[model samples]
Structures are given as C-alpha cells and as structure tokens.
Target: MYLFILLPVILYILIRKKSFKKVLRLHKVSPQQIFITMLLILAIQPMTALAARIMEHLLGHGFFPPMGDMSANGSGNLFMSLFIIAVTPAICEEVFMRGVVLDGYRHIPLWKTAIMNGVLFGLFHNNFMQLSYTSIVGIILTYVVVFTNSIYPAILMHFVMNALSVLMEKYPTSLYANFTIWYETNMVLLILLAIVSICATILLLIWLKRLSNNSAIESMDASDNSIEASDALNHTITFVEWPLMLATAISVIYSLMMVYAM
Candidate 1:
C-alpha cells in the first residue's frame, strides 16, 4: 500500500511536468455528487458479484484462493482490520491507479482511459478471482473520477466497499450461518433484494449517463480553447511505448503463472 503511493510520487517528480494536484485530480465535488457516488456503488455491488461469479466459472476454482490467508488468521481487532484492509488500500491504491496511472492516459478518450485503467488495475491484483471484479470496480471508479473531476468520490467508494468486505470476512462463519438461516426463512426477501439490485443498478447507470453528459456540456461551454487542446492531446500511442507495454506484459505473465501454479 505504501509503495503504491510512494512509487507514483517518485515517478511524478522524475517525469511528469504537470503539477501533482492536476495529475492526481485533487479537486472538489459537490455533496450531492458524493451522495450519488455512494448510491452508484450500492447499486453496482450485485453486478460486481455477478462478474466475479462469471470469472470463477470461466477460470475454475483452482485459479483463485482466498487472498492472504485472512480466513485462517483473522485480524481480531476491528480497527486494525479496517486500517489494513480498507483505509490503506482506499488511499494508496487510488493514489497509484486513479491518480497516477489513469492520469498518465488522460490525453486519450475517457472511455478508453477508463478501460485501460480497469485492465491495469485487474492485472495489478495478479489473481484471477479479483481481476474481473476489481477491473469492473476500477472502471466505475475511473468514470466517477473523470465525471466529477475529483478523487474523493472514488476513495470514499473504495473505502466503503473494502470496509464491507472486512466485515464479511471478519465473521465469516457467523455471517454464513445467519445467511443460511435467513435464506431458508426469507427466500422471498432474497429474491426481492436481487430484483431491486438489478433495477437500481440500471437506474443508476442512466442517472450517471445524464450527469456525465451535462458535465461535458458545461465543460465545453466553459472553454473552447481547452477543448481544442484536449482534442490535440487525444492522439493514440503505439506499443512501442516500452514502459507501459513491459509493465502490462509482466503483470499478465505473472498472473497467468499464478493461475496455472494453483
């Protein structure tokens, strides 16, 4: 976690001409925007699980084991668990992925940038199980950062999601027991929740699209000169960009090795 932040800062100092604030998108967003970001994350939770299940089915069980033996030796302390699993990654990974790496590709179209950011994030995990879901989450976080023009929303969303995971893992046996009983007792409610999640997710995407469109229009109106510069900067690059290509290749190769070795 510390390395993520530190490496990015070092690279920025050595290479990037832009100020850290601009590169990292340390801008402000409205309270309502933050609330919407939270709602969007809630809506997407079911979809993320679905993506993970799909990946697991395609890759098979052997490809992914529980990360870090968290189940065998649980954190025991709630605050420590939260600090290790939630707070640290929320800050460090976001700083590295969304702040440094995503910013490196900002000259490209937003969708392409988001997709690349997602893929890189997935590979960064070096595990099949996490790759699919984390990629999806990364794309969503990238979109949120780009649309809101701020990093706080992504950080908050990451923290919330990680905190939930920590809770789930911290008391897995208890949670599983309660879930089994609840499923047996309230199958109808479970179905309803699933249906609601699907519907809410669709609605949130529509809402986000409209919000993004409005923001784009406002940005265009605000500066024609900036738009021209943005367009000029949006040209494609080749794989001859050795640094990016090499990093991507290494990540993919290592992940494949881990998968097969399992």
Candidate 2:
C-alpha cells in the first residue's frame, strides 16, 4: 500500500503542489461505462489465459503459480481471500499504474503511453511467465482509464479479473475448470477461441471508447496543461532515471534467482 498508493500521493503533492486527484485521473465515470469495462476485461480472458497456458506448457506446469493462489490458502475464508487476492491489488495497483504512472506519461501520445505503461507493469512483476499476459492486460487497463477519463473503471475491471480467478481457484470443479481441461487437449480449438476473444476485445474497446465523455477528457488535459507553467515539477521523468533503473535491476535479479532456485 505504501509503495503503490501512499508514496505516489506524497510525491505528487510534493512536486505538483496541486490536488492529487487531477494528477491521479480520478474523474467520475458512468455506471454503463464501468459495466462495459468489466465486459471488456472478461472478453480479454481467453487471450491472457492462452498466453499463460502456452508459457506454462513450454516451461512445464507448476513453474510459476498464480500469485493469488500463493497468498490465499484454504485457511482463509472466501471474503478474506477475495479481499487479499483481488480487492487490495485492484485499488493499490490501479492507483499506481493508471493514476500516477499514466499521468506522468501524459505528454506522450496515448498509444505510446499505454504501451510503455504496460511494459513497465509487466516488468514490475519480475516473472517471465506472467510478463506477456500481464503486459497485455496492463495496456488494456491503461486504455480503460484513458477512455473513461476515470480511474474507477480500471479498478473495477482489475477487481473483476482477480476476483474471478480467486473464485475459480476456490471451486476447481466449476464449468471454467471443465472448459480448461477440454481446452488444454484441443490446440485447434484453443487458437480459434483466442482469436474470437481478441476480436471481441477489440469491439468492446471501441464501444467503450465511443461511450467515453470526450469533453471531460479534454477538460482534464487542459486543466493539467494549464498548471504546467507554474508547476516546476511538471517535467516528465525519463526511463534512465536511477530509481527506475535500480528497481528494474532488482526485479530481474530476483526473477533470475527464482528461476535457478527452482
């Protein structure tokens, strides 16, 4: 919480001397917008699952367990597990990624910003198995925040994704599990399903973008730009910064250690 949430808030306040909410992109979004965002994330599941499953097949099963499963055990109840595995990360990570990180990259074009944000997020995880799919999801989440001009939709999307994972983990005999069993055996079907899901994901994203309030997004951008002249800390940080470099190096070393240790 301190690293992802509080630290960003402190840095924003110290630098911008402005309301952290604007920098955090905390604009309010409509209910329909959030619902569509949830659907978008659900649509993305097959693709992400395919990425993870393919990597798992290549590396052998039991290599990189789901972080949620690692932390949430049978000792925890459903609510506790959900809170630990889903809710907390949704809030904390969204605040850091979609809020602080995205805002920092505002000067760049949307596509570049989203991709870079996604890459950073993937690297943040430090696990080779998760890097691809999480980066894809991170890109989608960044676009979610950008389209809706709000952080809440991304948070909801994140929660739904993780919560479903937790629920599925809890109930191994669920339909999803059955489907996964079948899916693993059918390579042709898996590829077809992944393609269809990707198409659906594209459609959902376009629909969500159309539903977004353009004026609000413009207003937010203008609001931030308006303050740039007076705010000395408005400058963007390059990737070469010592803090980012150090963090990346640590993550890589840790991931390598885990791989060799296993």
Candidate 3:
C-alpha cells in the first residue's frame, strides 16, 4: 500500500521534468522550525486520540482493532514492525500527500489547500474511524509542511506519531502509559488536557506560520519577479474532477459497510 501510494507521484514528477528536490521540498529548515514542529505534533496527540475515541463510540468498538502487538520480545521483530508501520508510511505517505497533492493545489489559497489536502488524506485511509482523527492530523501535517516549506518536518511528524505508539506499547510502564491510563479514566481531565494542548498547538502553528511568511517575503524580494513566476503563482483551476469524486464515493461506501457489518 505504501509503495502503491508513492510510485505514481515519483513517476509524475519525472514525466513533468520537475526537480525532485523542489517537488518534495527537500530543502533545509531552521532549528526553531524543527523544534516547533516536534512540539506541535506532540501537542495534538491527546486531541487526536479524543477524536478517535469519539469516532469509535459512534461507529462501535473494535471497528478497526490493532492487528497484533508491535511490542514483540525480539529486537528483530520490533524493528521490522517499526519499519513496516512507521518508516514506510512516513516516507511514502508524506511524499504523496505533502509532496505531490499539495503541489497540485498550490494555486488555491493556503487554508483551502490545507483543508482540502487534509480531507483527501483522511479519505485515502478508507477507514471511517481513522477518518475522524487522521483528518485532524492531516490538517496539522499539511500546515507543518507548508510553514516549514520542507517535507522532512512532515515526515518526522508522521514517524514520531507512529513510532511513539510502538515504543509506548513496548514499554507498558512508561510515563506515557501511566498518563493514558489516568486520562482515559478521568473524563473531565481528558477534556481539559485536550483543550489545553489544542490551544498550544494552534499558538505554535501561528508562530511557525509567521516565521514562514517572513522567509517567503524575503525570498520574493531576492528573486526576479518574472512573468512566468507571477503567472504560476496566480494561476487558478477547478479542483473538482472525476477521479477524486469516484474515490470519495468508494471510500464512503466501503467505510459505511465496514462500520455496519461489525
């Protein structure tokens, strides 16, 4: 599935003769941006968990249970699980989402691009329960990519989220596990923590965006404002197409069946 998601994006870049570096935004970002991206990713987790819980409650429990524990005893199995669950999706999914899909929507306004990309990303998962929280994660991931103007931050975000789950499961007595136990038991505290973390995430994102905007302005000032460049930035196009519509319909129908069947 990871390769299936990524291969077409690579081929499209090659066929279009676009620079891989530019398409993937492989340029470096500042330490400050990297730090904030890490914090933003961590801060949003509780809220995302809450969203997923709410979705499960609505869809019924065990709708999408974990296939098996990633916390196997052997180091070999652990590494393999991490590679399959975390690393592969982090690279492949980020390339498709933030790399190609985002570049395709560059003509749209920033917020529009982020929201649409996020929604499409959630649907791409084809799981109703995941769609609830992954959409939220996707929006934040898009913002991280956009603000940093580098795909690496988004890749890190994806890896950290998945890897943490694997590691925390491996070490059940970890601080994160203790916190999860308490948080799940206390409804009020869970709500309060989620709200606080969400606010922090927004503040951090705004700061990152401010820094990104400053950098963008400086770059524009340094560049020759060629007609071609201006046209590319100003270009607009209809976002609705048959492929996306078809995919959305299929995912919706499949998710509905799964939700009700179980």
RMSD in angstroms between candidate 1 and the native structure over all alpha carbons: 5.7
* Superposed Cα RMSD, model 2: 5.5
Q: TM-score for every candidate vs. truth?
A: 0.72, 0.78, 0.80
Candidate 3 Cα deviation (angstroms), residue 146: 0.8
lDDT of 1 by residue, 1-262 (tens): 4653446455654684667777678887777787788898777765566566567668777433553454333447777778877888788778777786766665455666778888878878766678888998888888777777778889999999887776666665786446633643454654565567668855765565566533533443344334464445434442125336644654565557656855
**CA lDDT of each candidate?**
0.67, 0.72, 0.73
| Candidate with the greatest lDDT versus the true structure | 3
Which has the greatest TM-score? 3
- The regions of model 1 sitting more than 4 angstroms off are 14-17, 62-68, 71-75, 173-199, 205-234, 238-262
Task: In model 1, state the lDDT of residue 63.
Answer: 33
Model 3, 1-262: lDDT tens digits are 3435666677778988998988788889899998998898779977887787778778878533463643342344778778877888799878877887777655455666667878888887876778878888899898888778899999999998888777666677999878876785576777888898899999999898887853532343333333255465444333544325533654465567656866
lDDT of the structure predicted as candidate 2: 0.72
RMSD of each: 5.7, 5.5, 5.9
- Candidate 3 global CA lDDT score: 0.73
Model 3 segments more than 4 A misplaced: 67-76, 213-237, 242-262
